[model samples]
Target: MNEFLAAGLVTALVAGFLGGGHCIGMCGGIVSALTFALPPSRRHPARIASLMLMYNLGRISSYTLAGTLVGGLGQLLVSNLQEVARILSWLAVIMLILMACYLGRWWQGLIRVEALGQHLWRYLEPLGRRLMPVTHPGQALLIGLIWGWLPCGLVYSMLILALSSGSALQGALLLLVFGLGTLPTLLLTGALARQVTSFFRQPLWRQASALLLLAFAFWQAMPLLGFARELPF
Candidate 1:
């Protein structure tokens, strides 16, 4: 269990870090809007930083909750019908591959999958807009919580990994770690929007991050592939 948790932590952190470019593409606009919501006089470095921190913490909390729910479902499934483990693992791999392709600029098939959430987002988006023109920490936090549900293939891919963990605690921890890894990039983006966005939007960054996602896919597949060494009798 300890080894499993450690591996999960590493995978979550790397995935989150490498997915920075995607994060910028998906959430940078939202960050920009929030940044601009402040009154000119209130936009000091310290004040902006604190609000961004609240936003990210709220976002990460949502991820953690999602992981807990999905991971718990996985646990229930695996416990009752052990064969389900194999199926869930494969699904996770497929999602990761699709995510990698999308991130790497190889293909953008995942956008169709992402489209599935639009119905829900349509309702939530209005609420998010209302919370905007943020004037307080509470409002910023609420905005982050709402935006956390924004549909992104990258986030869904990570959620799949959490589901494969087959334990609510593990899943929550995995997503928490992933969220932390993403925190620095987003916080910086809030402070220096154009510069940070331009840096992460680079083709090279996208491709490299895609490679990392592919590696994570393979890592998850290693056990299912039966790559464990045979005993030397």
Candidate 2:
């Protein structure tokens, strides 16, 4: 049970760190836009923090719904709970590696392969834009949920991880934690807007974050690589 909790927490942090990179790259604009949306009178840190939390709550709620649906389907595929759990464990390892590569920029090499998804995103892009002129916290929250499904390898990788949970509830909870982990970084970006975005874009930070993610990936996967049998868990 401890191991499972550890995996969930590690997965959440890694998901946030890795996904945060892409968030900086792509969704950074959203953060910036959100900052401007607020009236100056309501721009106090406390108020901003409350709005950020609400936004995250909405985003994480979407993740939970998605995970529950997928995990439910996964449960139906197996008669043995043990087998499902084993599958989830291995899938988490795989996601860890993929997210590591993604953060490292190594996964960019596969862009040619992923180009097909672009066509789908092209259609979805305009739909998201239609939600523009967001006037309320609820609007921003709902928009984030719609945008959550936006095609990106990072999100797809996490979705794969979510699917591995074997049970709907577990999958939902895992994704919620993952979303929560991402919340702070994103909230800061929203608050600071362009400055934070620029800071994250610094080559040094990117490289450092990438390396950190890679190290965590290995840490998460090492135990599963038959090393525990030779050493101690």
Question: What lDDT would candidate 2 get against the real structure?
Answer: 0.65
What TM-score, over all chains together, does every model reach?
A: 0.94, 0.79
On TM-score, the leading prediction is 1
Query: Which candidate wins on lDDT?
Result: 1
Off-target runs (Cα >4 Å) in candidate 1 are 229-233
TM-score for candidate 2: 0.79
Error of 2 at 129 (Å): 2.9
* Per-residue lDDT of model 2, residues 202-229, tens digit only: 7677677777766665666666676542
lDDT of candidates 1 onward, in order? 0.84, 0.65
- Residue 131, candidate 1: C-alpha displacement in angstroms: 0.9
Per-residue lDDT tens digits of candidate 1, residues 158-222?
78888877899988998899899899899889988989889888999889899988987788777
